[model samples]
Every structure is written in structure tokens, then in C-alpha cells.
Target: MQTRALRTGGFDLLVSGLLAACLLTLCGCTSDRAIAKKEKATHVVPVKTVAVETTQVQRSTLQPATVHAFYRAEIRAKASGFVKNLQADIGDYVEAGAKLAEIDVPEMLMQRQVIDKRIERLIAEEQRGQAGVRLAEARVRSAQALLAEASSQMAGAEASLAASQAEFDRTEDLVERGSLQNRMLDESRMKRDSEAARRDAMASSIESAKAEVAVAEAQVVAAQAASDAAQAETEIERSQRQEMDALLDYATLRAPFAGVVTQRNLEPGDLVRQSNEVGRGQPLFVISQVDRVRVRIAVPEAEAALVNPGDEVTLTFPSFSAAQPIVAAVTRTSGSLDPSTRTMLVEVELDNQDGKLLPGMFGQASIHLDSKVAAQTLPSRAIRFDEEGNGYVYVVGEDETIARADITTGLDDGNSIEVLSGIEPGQRVVGPHLKRFSDGQKVAVLPN
Candidate 1:
């Protein structure tokens, strides 16, 4: 009976041990399967992508500018004097040759009066000299008449002397023959001698008359010289008077063109002087041609090559809030870069017929450059840098796994970069997963 009971207990213990071993094996297999599934799901990386498109890109440059007049002028006082009246004020429109201001020149007027008086005196002197010349001519004629009378008297006296001499000769012959008395012959001879003396006196008188005529001729010459001198003096005085009159006219200022008086420096009764300082040419009043305006800008040396004359440009002025942008064309350039600022000067012209724009206004300009070839551009954030300082991106492979790609870059326009190589259009790239990426990493793509 004791042997049979011990065998039954040993059999039951063996059965319990076998069942526990089988259960342990089954639980180990199930845990290994669960771990494999978790590892496969967690190791795969999901990435975002962008589509590449071919489009035209414009190269542009922006710069600050200033508005100016096409032609500006500064009006100054040409003649010095006291301002008498002001005809135009600031912001007044004036035509060419219009009166601007008038000056009081009392000294000039007095000078003209003096010149006139001198001319009158010279004329009076000339007339007096002419009268003297006429008087001298009359005296010469009177002297000539007296000389003719003296000549006639001398001829008569000579005839009488000849007759008396003939008689004396005959009387002397008779006395020799005792036909006449000696007293009679002496009387005849006395008569002849007296007539001869009378003829000599008349001849002397004629000579004196000729001398008087010569004196009269000299007087006429002197009078003519005086008249010529007086005429010359009158001409000189007349010329002086004309010059003073011209100076008086210069005292009145006039506008040189049709434009608005943008500035006023002096008023009535103000004293203005001419400017002679270097670089400060003049400072009386400012004038500008408001029919057209100009804008000047300085472009940097790196971008100056892209601008050209006649190109369209836009200008904006801060002074006008509701004013539309002024459209203009590039008129000219400075042609050389400035060494100090490394910029080139540019000018644009615009119409301002309404006088809305003024000189010295601040503005800005935008210049369009040449168009570039169609290229694939990516966002700047898509690019990545490695430890070796090489730029690259993560490209999605056919099996949807991540692979590191090396790329060459071109121009960067602040928002996007031109991809030169190492990537094709339509290829999926990792979107900024720079910190959590590795070579040949498994990835899951995100929907667009």
C-alpha cells in the first residue's frame, strides 16, 4: 500500500513542471515581435518639399534721390542805388522784360542836368565865335575898298606931275632964248615937285590899307579856330549826357524771363550790393523754371552699370501725400563714379506745368536692371551647411529615404537663392530639418 501512493505523487509534480516551461517560451516570442514593430515605425523621418518653377527674374536696385529744377537762377542788382519801389514780391509770376523794382538815382539825374547846362554853354560860345568870324570878314571888305580908292588917287597925282614937268622943260628953253622970265620957270618946277610928293603919299596910303586887310584875315582865322573848339566841346558834352541817361535806365530792375519769383531778398528802401565772393556767386533773389523739373540720384558703383539714359523711372516725394508718383525718364548721367561715395550720379526729367513741384525736395528712385535667364530658385532657408563649410540639401530618393546632396549656389536675392547644380526640378528636398538629419536616413513625406 505505501509504494503505490508515492508513485502517484511523483507523476503529478512532473506534469506541473512541463506546463510552466511551455508558457515561458510563448511570452518571450510575443515580446520580441512587439519590439521589432516599434523600432521600424520610430526610425523613419518625415520631410516637407517645394516645387521648382521656371520664371523670369528682374535685377533691381533702390536708392535715395532729390528733386531739383532743370534751370535755376539768382537775380542780383546790376546797378547800385537806393530802392525806390518793389513791384513784385515772393511767389509772384513775372514775364520777360517785366519791371521788378525801381531805384531812386538823384545823383544820376543831377549829373544829367549838369551835362545839359554844359552843352548849352558850349552852343552859346560857338555862336559868338561865328559872329566874330563874320565881323572880321566885313572888316576885310572895308579895307579892300579903301585900298582901291588910294590906288585911284595915286594915279591922278602922277598924271599931274608928268604935265608939270613938260611945262617946265618948255619954259627953260624960252628963257634961254629970252622969250620967258626966270620966275615963271621956277614956279612950274615947284608945281612938278609938289605933285610928285603927293603921288608918293597916296602910294604909302595904299600900302597901309593892304596891311589892314592882312590883319583882318588873321582875325578871321583866329575866330574860326575858336568856333571849331566850341563845336568839339559841345559834342563831348552831348556824349556825356547820353551816358548818364543810360545809367539812369539801368537803375530800374527788370525780369529776364517768364517765371515765378520764388525768393525775395529786399523790399522798398533797401540797399543791395553786388556779390564778388567765390562759390557764393550772387544772393538777391532766386528764380526757377517751373515748367519742368528734375530729380538727381546717386547709384552705387556695383549697380550703376545696369542703368542707361532714356530708361523709365518713378519718383516719390514725401511732401505730397495724395500726389501720384511722378513719372520721368533718365535724362543723363555723371559718366564717372564718385571716388568719395563710390556712386554714379543720375538725373531724371519730369513735367511740372502746374507748379506743384519745387526745387530741393527729397525723393527716391527705383532702377530696373537686365533680365536673367530662367533658373530654379529655392527658399534661402532650404540650404544647409555642414561641418566642412560646404553648402548642401537633403534630397528624397526613389525609396522615400533621405540622402545628403552637395550643391553649388549662385546669386542670393535676400529671399531666395539660385541653385546652380546638384539638384533637379521636381525633386523632393528636406525642408529645414538641419539639426535632426543623417545620411541615408529613412523619411516620411508630408503633404503639401
Candidate 2:
């Protein structure tokens, strides 16, 4: 009986120990389950919702620029004088040949009047010279008449002498033959000698008349030369008068072109001089043609190749919010690149027929490049660079969680950036952040 009892006690002890072990194992399992439930409830995962939609992505460049008038002119006074009247003021629209200002050029007008008087006097003098020439011609005619009369008298005297010499020769022969008396021979000789003397006297008179004719001819030639000289002087004086008259007319300033007067420098009664420093040509008015305007933009050299003539661009002026964006065409470009800024100069032309655009206005230019392969565009803030300069984004996963993704990027057009690869359309991207946000972090998006 004692042996049986000992065996039973041992069995009881073993059973009790087995029951305790089973209870401990169940309690341990319960504790483990509770801990796991608490941990699962506390862990928060990052999430961002995404929707798929089509969006246009444009790769463009922004350039600062200014508006300029295509045609500009500085109106100046061409003649030196005191300003008499100013017809136009700044901001006045004027047509071509419109009078802008008038100068009081009394001195010039008086000079012209004097020149005119001189011209008239020269004309009278020329007429007098012509009369003198006529008088000299009449004297030449008189001298010719006298020379002809003297020639006729000389011929008569020569004939009479020849007759007398013949008679003398006959009388001398008769006397030698004793049929003629000495007195007859002497009378014949004396008559011949007197006729000869008269002939010689007539020849001398003809020579004197010829000399007088030569003197009269010389006088005529001299008078004609004087008349020609006087005529030339008259022409020169007339030309001078005309030139002075033109100068007087130029005293009135007129618009050089059809444009708006941008500036006015002088007022009425202001004295103007020829030297610009002395306020001569001091831009009595400034005119500019605003029908067409120019915008000069400096584009970075890296992208300058894409900018060329004929390219369309959009511009915005800061002053007016309601103003519509102006569309302009690239008219030309500065072929050389600026070394300081590494930029090229580009000029764009825009129509401004309404005169709404003004020169020297600041603006911005947007130039679109050729279309590239469809790329994913994200808000510029979505991209973050690590310490090594590698860009990445936080992408939402299927379980409403976040995953960090690496992406390659291209041009950033202010608001958005082009995702060349590693991103897709409709992907959720973070907006600009005030502080750095980690990947996989949960975020609540504000209502748009």
C-alpha cells in the first residue's frame, strides 16, 4: 500500500506541473497579441493622392527687356534765332511737315531785304553798262563814216595830181621845142605840186580817221567787258539774296516725321544758338513713331541658338494687370554674345498702332522652344536635391503610402519643371515647401 501511494503522488505532481506550463504559454501569447495591436495602431505612413490627367508642358525661357520705339527723332532748330512761338508741346501728336515752333529771325529777314536791294541796284548798273555799250557802238559808226569820206577825198586829189603832172610834162616839152612859154611850164608844175600836196594831206587825214576808228573799237570792247562783269556781279548778288531768304524760312521749325512729340526743350522767347552746348539744336521737340515698337531682350547664350528671326514671343508689362499680353515677332538678334552676361541681344517687333505702348517700359519676354517628347511636368517645388545634387520626389503608393523616386529633370519654366523621365502624368507632386519634408511622410493637401 505504501509503494502504491508514493507512485500516485509523483503522478499528481507531474500533472500539476504540466497544467501550470500550459497556462503560462497561453498568457504569454495574449500579451504578445496586445503589444502587436498597439504598435500597429501607432505607426503612421506618408500618403499623397494622385489623379491622372492630361496637361500641356511648355519649355520656355524668360528674359528681361524694355520697349523701344522703332523710329525716333530729335527735332532741332536749323536756324539760329529767338523762339517766337511754340505750336506743339510734349505728348502732342504731329504729322509730317507740321509746324512745331517758329523763330523770330528779324535780323535774317532784314539781311534778305538788304540783299534784295543790292540785287536791284546791280540790275540798274547792268542796264547802265548796256547803254554805255550802245554809245560805244554809235561812236564806232561815226568813225567809220568819217574814214570813208576821207578816203573819197584822197582819191579825188590823186586823180587831179595825175592830170596836172601830165600837163606839166607836155608844157616842158613844148618850151624845149620853142612852141611853149616858160610861164605855162611853170604854171603846170605848180598845179601838179599843189595837187600832190593835197593828195598827201588827204592821206594823212585818212590815217587819222583810221586811228580814231581803232580807238572807238577799243572803247566798245572795253564797255562790253565791263557790261559782262556787271552782269556776273548781279547774278552773284541775286544768288546771295535767295540764299538768305531760304535761311530765313528755315528759322521755322517743322516736324521731321509723323510721330508723337515726346519732349519739348524750348519755350517762346527763348534764344537758340547753333552750338548744341549753347542750347542750339536743343531738341525743341522729340518725335517718335509708335506705329511699330521694338523690345530688346537679352537671352542667355546657352539657349540663344533657339531664338532666331521670325520666332513668336509673348510679352507682359508690369504696370497694367488687365493689359493683354502682347505678341511680337523676333525681328533680329545681335549675332555676338555678350561676354559679361553670356547672353545674346534679341529684338522683337510689335504693332502699336493705337499708341498704347511706350518706349523705355520694362517687360518680360517668354520664348517657346521647339516641342520635345512628351514629358511629365511637376510643380517646381516637387523636386528636391540631395546633398550630392541628385533630384528625387515622394511618390504615393497603392496602400496610400509614399515612396521616394529618382527622376531626371530638364528646363524649369518658373512654375513647372519638365520631367524628362522617371515620372508620369497625373503624379502627385508637393508644392513649394517652407521647410524640408522627408520621404514617406504623411501630408494633408489643402483644398484648391
Q: Among these predicted structures, which one has the highest lDDT?
A: 2
lDDT of 1 by residue, 1-448 (tens): 8999999999999998999998998899998889997796567766787654455554556689887877777777656777888898888888887788887887778889989999999999999999999998998999889989998998898899888889888988998899999998899889989998999999999999999999998988999999999999999998888888777777777777777788888878887653445337445666677778778999999988878997667677788857887666789999899999999999988888987778888877866555556668777688887798677888888888777889887655545667878888888787766555767777888897
Alpha-carbon local distance difference test for all models: 0.80, 0.81
Least well predicted 10-residue stretch by lDDT in candidate 2: 45-54
In TM-score terms, which candidate is top? Answer: 2
lDDT of 2 by residue, 208-307 (tens): 9999899899989988888898899999998888788777768878887888899898988899865445444456678988888888999998899888
In Å, residue 395's CA in model 2 sits off its true spot by: 5.6
Error of 1 at 114 (Å): 3.5
Error of 1 at 261 (Å): 2.1
Once model 1 is optimally superposed onto the true structure by TM-score, how far is the C-alpha of residue 175 displaced, in angstroms? Answer: 36
Model 1, residue 276: C-alpha shift (Å): 4.0
Error of 1 at 187 (Å): 31
> Any runs in candidate 1 off by more than 4 Å, and if so which?
1-52, 115-246, 277-282, 320-324, 371-448
Model 1 vs. true fold: TM = 0.52
